[model samples]
Target: MAFWIFLPITLSAVSLIGCWTVYGLALRFNHICSLRNWEYSNSCLTNKTVTGGCCTEYNIPTISGSGTQFPENSLFSATINAASFLFVIFSIFHYAHILKKCTVHRFFSKSAMVFGCLAGVGAFVAGNCNPGELMFLHYLGSALSFVCICFYTVLLTFLTSTCILTGLERFLYPVRIVFSIVQVTLTILYCIFFTQKDFYYRHISAIFEWTLSMNLELFELSYAVEFYFFSSSMLSVLLSNRDEENTMILS
Candidate 1:
């Protein structure tokens, strides 16, 4: 009973930590990349002086005085790449553990693991691109991840529907199906509309305007939602079974 209760919490913690680790790695990568073309000299532009100053075009500014030295895009990519790699490993291990237990929804669990692996790899590769080039990679990677999310959502819906129909429970069936449909529709719309070149430029414009960060928060949100849904479904099944056993014993 305790194991069932703890499993979701543990998985959630691991996933969140993994995400943070990826974010840190991205910051480091950005710092390293920014240092390559940075200048370190008195000629550094402080506030766009209009004076006819004696300045060299390729002047090396001091590390401390260089303007906007932080490579936000690179850092974001690095974090995603690192985090995705760790996520892949974690998902694989989790899948194996679940399989060993012979869970009722093994099919859904296995499918989620496989799709999670693909999403992780895609994210890592997409994270390797620079700012201007990141759009293409990000779009492609995000599309793949969203597709996996849709699959997982559908699988969970099916599992939940089956469990309910089998007289396992009654209340969760309609709710699961409705959530699953909504997720599937939203994922499809995201893939179709958001992955376009025009949409990428629109986001770039927002980034330039400082309204949005280099990292696509939407991707993170999608992952979080899917994770929650799947994790909840798994927990529901475990809890329902436990309750059944208790009822049997009581009778």
Candidate 2:
């Protein structure tokens, strides 16, 4: 049970740090970027300049090309897709186990499972379809990924709120709800503004996109409490014995 949480948390941290590092480095080396800044740009015209570095933000998905080199670009995209797939897939199994233990109806678990898998597939599509190359497909994948992820988070938050599952705390429900709201709101705003032709709109949208990404990563980190409650070794299935389970059962 603990390792389930720890693994996802570690995955989120590594993915966030790795993507940020590569994007920042690539932005630094992009001499043709006009300025080394961090805001999103509708176009990468050499005249654009931001405060920190040269930023040619199209959509967040295009960030993989920030490195402006094959190694940097490919590495970032691959890292993102791989992490997204692995984390989501593992999460599906984790949730499935919880659902089984609780004897949750198939509908609730199926919704989460389907959306979770879709989110993973969306990530893979978005990561692979470079905005610079396949603009339409990239945006499509990004849209799907963001929307599905938002719903997925909300569903999981609801699941937590029910308090029917073991190894989760009651107090965490409201916190998860708040985070899910923020994530969904940002996703909506980003979709609206990210498509605008104006510079400020695009820049603001980029910030929204970044915020949403960081929010998801941070949300994943909150599982540290769950991680602390169990041991790492075979913890996923080594749930409490029947006697202990009887003691903890809510009803």
Candidate 3:
């Protein structure tokens, strides 16, 4: 029970911590930029010269790329990769434990875990490869990770809908269905927008990518509630069957 609960907690904590770490780095260096702005502007300009205190480039809703721009770029990459690796391990454990509890979707469950791990590895490869340096390996990793993550979410959504285990139908089924659909939709949009040479499309692509990434992280966090109850639920199911068998034998 304790170990089972730890998986979601770790996933949530690691993801939030990594995200905030990047955010903090951006804030610390005053690189805040709007995610949806047509032009990628940062606080580097805002902090430069404020004669009348009207910096036209000062935008709020920080774009994900600003965190990876300059000064703190390496730190952002390293932090994100480390967190990605840890989350990957936790994701595998999570899926494996679910498989143990509900053997209903054995193949799908296992496949989700496998692809989750692959996505994690691809994330690591992409983050560490720095697009400015090893663009090829980085792009390759990005493609692998995105595609695998899409499949992983779809499989995970199916698992939730199965409702094989007790006490989780309300938690997993309908909510995950919506999230999965949104994730895949955003993925398709990202694919379409990411390669556009136009600067406007590029920014839109970045926005979609950021939304997709954050959505996935929040999805992991949502499992906290599921994990909290699932451990006991699994134990109950196991013990109940055993006790039933014992009573029948005694009869």
* Candidate topping lDDT: 3
Residue pairs whose backbone atoms clash in candidate 1: 22-79, 26-75, 26-79, 39-60, 39-61, 40-60, 40-61, 40-62, 41-61, 41-62
lDDT of 2 by residue, 9-88 (tens): 77687678777776666555552232223455545455543334334443232343453355576777867777777767
Name the better of 2 and 3 by TM-score.
2
Give me the displacement of residue 77 in model 1, in angstroms.
2.3
Q: Model 2 clash tally?
A: 8
In model 2, the clashing pairs are: 1-235, 1-236, 26-67, 35-54, 36-53, 36-54, 37-53, 37-54
lDDT of each residue in 25-50, candidate 3, tens digit only: 66555555444335443343535322
| Segments in model 1 whose C-alpha atoms lie over 4 Å from true places | 1-70, 103-108, 134-136, 160-179, 195-251
Please tell me which predicted candidate would have the highest TM-score against the true structure: 2
lDDT of each: 0.45, 0.65, 0.67
TM-score of each: 0.44, 0.76, 0.74
Candidate 1 structure quality by residue, lDDT tens digits, 175-203: 55665666566555544543344523323
Regions more than 4 Å wrong, model 3: 2-6, 27-33, 40-64, 67-70, 229-251
Candidate 2 has an lDDT of: 0.65
